[model samples]
Target chain A: MERKNFLRTFALVAATGPMIIDGCKKDSATKSTTSTTGTTTSTTTSASSGCVVTPTETEGPYPYVGGEATNPLNRVDVTDGQTGVPLSITFLVVNTNDNCNVVSDARVDIWHCNKDGYYSGYANQPGLLGSKSYVGETWLRGYELSDSNGAAKFTTIYPGWYGGRATHIHIEVYVNSVMKKTSQVTFLETISDVVHVSTLYAAHGVNPVRNASDSVFGDSATDLANEIMTLVGSVSAGYAGTYTIGLAL
Target chain B: MYKAKIKLVYKQVIDASSETSFEKAIIHASYQEFLLKSQAYNAEGKFKTFSRMKANDGRANSLHYKLSFSVLHFIEQLDNKIPVIKDNLGNKLSFDTAAFELIESHIEDSSLHKVAINYQTETLTLIDFMGDYLLLTSADAKSNEPSETFVVKMQPGLSIMNYQEINQFAINNLQLETP
Candidate 1:
């Protein structure tokens, strides 16, 4: 009985040994081939190779400024070819972390319409009331750096109502010379009615009704109506308004 | 006495909007990734076995190294899918994309060892593994004859660069008129 039990144990051990050896052999064989063929390439540290190094230089045929360059409205006239009483717009630029103070070098470029309901530099069509200057022209639309407070201001005339859409202005912001965002500001229609009745729109011969129907104006308009505010009791002279924008860099 | 011929094929397209600098960076990155991932196997002194093992088995550290390199090559190729833009002056710019592909190894030898790899936007095909023509006896019988032949194919995807990034880079770097 002792000899029989010993033989049984020996047989079982032999069977398991071959199975384990075979498994190890199979693994080794695979490793051999892989090592032979795999000596082809590497992956780690590859991502860093994608980095690009750029040279620094300054080059420009920058736009010209007219009127009071100190005010945002005047700067818009120089850039967008708009004239008359300038619109005062202000905005804050922030970064990915929602930090409003992005940096001093952030550039802000703004452009919009004129009092007579037309862009200055654009050639006026025969039937159009005002000259064409802003159409396709980017001269007046240029960039300006932010102050230490991450604040930027632009001076431009209140855009006349056009194309049945509300009056508005377009703005683009750049951080450290990189374009980061684009937006627009709208004016209240109720304010337009007030301007028309007060002769502010008439002083510039800009019919708010006509501007409300402009095709481009209609499509490009944003909701700046609530933000529009006229300088109280200044009905005799050109209209004045200010807009403040808060940006997420 | 066994002899075999191996062929390597690669294919890729530069995004139409990609700047020359960005393309250069991507190519360099790909090469680095490939080198880091490929492995070298030494079979000079080891005992020969009947069945083959998977390349990634931990017990086969040498083989694992090779597999890792192949995977790295694939990752590098796929990395091209990330769009890059650069100013003409060589400043790096950021962009986004949808997909990419990479193929590291597609090798075929007369020893009946065939490997085909396909990943991302690339495909590799290899054929003709250990066969009678790869045997020492067969080579001895045909001492002066040509060795076995095999084929490999690779189809790399297009690398796309963002138009807006390029436009911005050019405008900022080249003094080009803003449109």
Candidate 2:
């Protein structure tokens, strides 16, 4: 009976050991953020090869704040029935502090302007769409948790360009409920050039500011390379874009 | 005037039922509370201090309190002056600033009342100013103890693109402008 009891105890420990370790890991990650200095860059000290800390950019005036309390939509397709060219945007999040390993279960949020360059959940978006209030509308804004592979994808339309900015998408990476990075990724000029002239986007015309002239992206080559996404598709069949974000979490 | 409010609370299970392992006595104490100040300044060019209040439910197991000023006042404190730089080659480079940070002690004695007994912290945040609001990862550390700081990001009622826009919008919202 003693042996049986010992075996039962051993089984319980084996079953809960991993879960306890995970809880500790999450707790440590949380502690690091509170003690972190002002920089929004990665707080960890490890330098993994090929992992560049994604440049921190402004979430602008239109990121969906308030998390679950706001929209409460955990979806993969942020199109929200808006008509435009279909695009599959993929992000691979790796931890520079963890040997560039994929960060599974990280929350990734993607938001951008519709084809006419109007963002949802705002009343002051000025563009071809005029001054429209999408105040209650949550189109083109949603979040998905990364899978075991540290990747999240969104089925979004080709984003439209707004004044004072190039065609780009805003992304936020949250690991263990802490926002590690808030950045924007721009499409290659070659890709934006084609999508802007397509049927739905034609009304807005091509974006005047290219990647090299963008306020956030044009600053340096490293910025552009870190934030630029690669697209492989056409306006007719839609495009698939991929970007890897490195965080010093 | 407080424009934005952010609160982070940490809970601890002080006592639990041994039979059921159910939490019986729990402490839901606030780790931090940040209130953004709106007044221009006082006689000493200082902002009003954050109001502190504590409350307890019928259980009497938790402590709730408010402390610290909002990090947004950093915008009003800005001189709004753009610095011009000239390189050795006699070329002028225009500088445009977009973001600002207010670094301060994340843990105060009042904030540690029930959450910690003896706390020693060296961590801080360069709180990022996002136009009309502020975004930061709230953190604190305790020597030789397991500590956790929840991520806290906030947006005021209005959000804008740049500092100019934030200034104009804040002024209008606060009615600081004179006719």
Candidate 3:
């Protein structure tokens, strides 16, 4: 009887060992983004405590890197003298696998579209809004460094939605000038649907996409709720929101 | 995003059976969600920061990759294998170095991946990126003969492509480093 019991135990271990090993291999792919700092490459890394690196995303074509108004790393205000409702964004950078510790001194870059769904510096580009171009135009893109406590802030307008995608802002995190992660952050659709859409955003048309429907958001559905910014102000005076983004370095 | 699957044929040894378990290995690739390529990204910039976005159903190469990974990720294809490269300059580097120069430097969307790899040499002879997830096995690794060929099977969303169009489209966009 003892020998039979031992054989049964052995069978269970043998049956489950390979699966356990296989599960270890995929842990990184599901937990972290570990690719090089390419424009759209995603490798994998492991994270235990902090949030996994935001999934890497395409660096959309219009990352205008022209001049000062375009580079807003030092100051809190990033409006660049453009016309739109007032909005402010903040980012908190942290390291992963280390109890979500704040990663100080890292550089963060942010860029988004103006209220009309057009990006700056691309002239006469056709869009849902018609064929007007901001060629040589530079607004709504810049870089900033995380403070000693891992905080970076930008003053700008709420991003307007285009036809194909939900509202989003792109960001890149860097340590020692090495690109560590690239991802898009989004607002609650209710905020865009009722506030930004109803007020200054009305003429462009309603933001028809929702979180469940957007592909990018759907791809990372489990993390979407955590990545969204929490807001406080009204559309009349302009909305303000704060976000805590944990980056696994 | 559309739904699709890719297949990979491999050779696996069945120790308990004492024979080839199957003539070839079987694998499939599937995604939980896919994003259609965005139209807002087509405008030309003085300097390009990202690549073109093709709708999820339209990216042929990425589809091929999903199929490839469904197989390669499960098999023992690259362990301790060395691929041969004969360069005029006679340069030798570690696999990490070679992988960095060859795939890491050229492709964007750098994410540090967790993969099980064990190699004897520093040479990145085992793997290289063709397009997205489609990994190219070094032609020299399988003795003098090339390994089994990989093919991408089109699903419901893709229309058939002519020979010329296949040659015209890039497998993956390579970022040219500026001085």
Candidate 4:
């Protein structure tokens, strides 16, 4: 398939938030805790070998482009399972480069599943009501432009999983008014287990498995698997994760 | 439209061979020719020009062009140049040295946005073209390295847009001569 077509298909899957959320919720429940710090050298067999730094040639300033302004796919009502207070996850976009040069005007598109293993905008799924599941609610998932040092912050609910993928959030980066790249960040399955412990397991008595058995969690080199930490029991309901990504322009 | 005054500086450094003198003379002559063309464009309502000047530094093997004008006018001039002088065609226009190094080609239309040419330690930098500025640094120097930082600060009247837009315009319109 052509690269553009491939991207279009992947984008469709990405826009379909409920399917992804369901996959994640199912996998997170049965997964075992894995190491968060070690590199995926053993698993990533097809990693790109050449590491030359080549400057990218500029294209047209592609203006007035339009797609879906926001996703209405999956909505997870976040509540502190223990205290019953609503939980809001604060996401901070951090630049991976050492310079910390904030990428101003860079757009960040983020989406994930809700707590009950249902997505917001999926139509075919009988589980989702199809009408307007959190469609107008921009609070859970939305887009934000990075500030001077390439930082963006959002308050959202902790995402849940569905069938066979780990608990992860998908992010798309647009630099200089063009969509440049996409990457998914995963919490350490152990950390995901902790989240499961706080919500599903703690409330309904369920335990999720490791990423190795998940259908979507394959040996793909492109997957940026890593561990991130949030305050377990803070005044802010302690549901948050920080993800750092480097964009090559 | 609000009137804005801005300055643009173009710089280039050449090699140090016996032919260097000949190269320098040709560069000076070409610089003059380029300036005359720019002035003609300005007169034709391509840009509103306050002044355009050139300077040469033999010690650095460098030549510089400084232009001051209104932002909107300069952009208008650039809009014309963008389609005419592509990278390939621009290369054919002739550099004094056959080995003339093109450090950077940042032209938007006929209005030269920023062009830097370097020969050895001698560096050429262009700044404050209409609303934006370009900076060139030695590849060897660290970010915190204590080197003479060439600074050309612009006045507050100019507006800065996204660099990507300018770069894109340059790439699409860039033409080089097919040898």
Query: B1-179 in candidate 3: lDDT tens per residue?
Result: 10112212211211122222111121101110011111122222221112223332234333222222222212222221222221223332112100100111001222211111121222112232244333222232323344542222222222212111111122222112211
**TM-score per candidate, chains pooled:** 0.33, 0.45, 0.42, 0.34
Q: What digit string (tens of lDDT, one per residue) describes model 3 on residues A1-249?
A: 554465468669879866754554544345444557557667544444433334435533221122223222235665777767778777888887678888887777677788888776454666667987553234786667899988888889888866677888887677765566667888887677765556567788667777768877766678787767887777778787787777665
**What TM-score number comes out for model 3?**
0.42
Candidate 2, residue B110: the lDDT equals: 30
TM-score ranking, best first: 2, 3, 4, 1
Candidate 2 Cα errors over 4 Å, as ranges: A1-71, B1-179
Off by over 4 Å in 1: A1-83, A123-142, A197-200, A203-244, B1-179
- Assess the local accuracy of residue B91 in candidate 2 as a C-alpha lDDT between 0 and 100: 37
Q: Score the docking of each candidate (DockQ).
A: 0.01, 0.02, 0.02, 0.01
Positional deviation of residue B39's Cα in model 3 after best superposition, in angstroms: 24
lDDT of 2 by residue, A1-249 (tens): 554465468669879866754444432232112243556643432123323222324433211222122223467898988989999988999999999999999988788989998886555667786787664456898788899999998999999888999899988777775567778999888889888998999988889998888888999988898788899999999999999989997
Candidate 3 Cα outliers beyond 4 Å, as residue runs: A1-75, B1-179
- Model 2: residue B127 alpha-carbon error in angstroms: 51
lDDT of 1 by residue, A47-156 (tens): 23342222212222111122122322223334344444444555556564564445565667665555545542243432235434332233334345667876666555
Pick the winner on TM-score between candidates 1 and 4: 4
The CA lDDT of each predicted structure is: 0.38, 0.53, 0.48, 0.37
